[model samples]
Target: MQKRYRIKREKEFQEVFAAGHSKANRNFVVYQIKKPGQTHYRVGISVGKKVGHTAVCRNQIKRYIRQSLLELSDQLPGDVDFLVIARANAKNLDMKETKTNLIHVLKLSQLLLEAQAE
Candidate 1:
């Protein structure tokens, strides 16, 4: 993801955590706030040591979540800031499951613009 589309600063994460509405499944938590003037979505991913003891494990989880978001970016709402927090069970999932679970969470939160009816 490009710098403009990624939320990199500490304060930005805090702002999202403080004000964004959130929803969660077993492996992930998503926080989002809609800002009126913004023209694109900015996302932050957080995978902590609690989720995995090794850096590689944490990074792999981050990569999977990022890939999922990237795939759905075009259909996601533009004026929102999203923060994705991975839970410990996330470390146990493979790439495909990660993407499916992430998309499921997005759908539950009503964040997926083109989400289809079941």
Candidate 2:
């Protein structure tokens, strides 16, 4: 994932977690904050340690989420900051499945502009 696309700062993450509203489905939790902006949609994916204790497992899930996001990043609106939080199910899910599920959640939450078929 590109550095500019990610929400890297601790303070930014905290503000999103605390002030942003979220909607959860079976596979992922979507937290979104709308910042009036002209460029870039800041995004972050968080998979909790409770989901998996091992580093390999956690990294794999993060990798899957990151890859999925990279594919759809261009379609995301510029003024919104999105945080995708993976659940325990993320550890075992495949790239295609995660992407399908994430797109579904994004649509249901009315966050994404494009239509979701899955």
Candidate 3:
């Protein structure tokens, strides 16, 4: 993901946590807040020590999430900020599983647009 499309500051994450609406499934928690006048959506990802024992594991999880978000970017709302926090159950998932779990959570949060049949 690009830096412009990511929420990278502690203050930004805290603001989202404080004011955003949240939804979750077994593997992920999604916090969403609308940002007026924003041209595109931004995302913040968090995979903590509890979810992964080492930095490599955590980074892998993050990579999976970033890839999923990239694939879904066109379907996401342009004026929203999303924060995705991974649960411990996410540690063992492969890329496909991660994307599936993320889609479930995003649907719950109403962040994902339905895919159009062409």
lDDT for each residue of candidate 2 in 15-105, tens digit (9 for 90 to 100): 9899898998888998888899548788888888988899888888888888877787766888878788888877778889888888888
What CA RMSD would candidate 3 show?
1.6
Please report the candidate that would top lDDT against the real structure.
3
Candidate number with greatest TM-score: 3
Model 2 RMSD in Å is 1.5
The local lDDT score (0 to 100) that residue 55 gets in candidate 3 is: 99
Locate the minimum summed-lDDT window of 10 residues in model 2.
109-118
State residue 80's C-alpha deviation in candidate 2, in Å.
1.0
- Rank list by lDDT: 3, 1, 2
Q: How do all models score by TM-score?
A: 0.95, 0.91, 0.96
Clashing pairs in 1: none
Pitting candidate 2 against candidate 3, the one with the higher TM-score is 3
Clash list (residue pairs), candidate 3: none
- Superposed on all Cα atoms, the candidates' RMSDs to the truth, in angstroms, are 1.5, 1.5, 1.6
Which of candidates 1 and 3 reaches a greater TM-score?
3
List ranges where model 1 is wrong by over 4 Å.
116-118
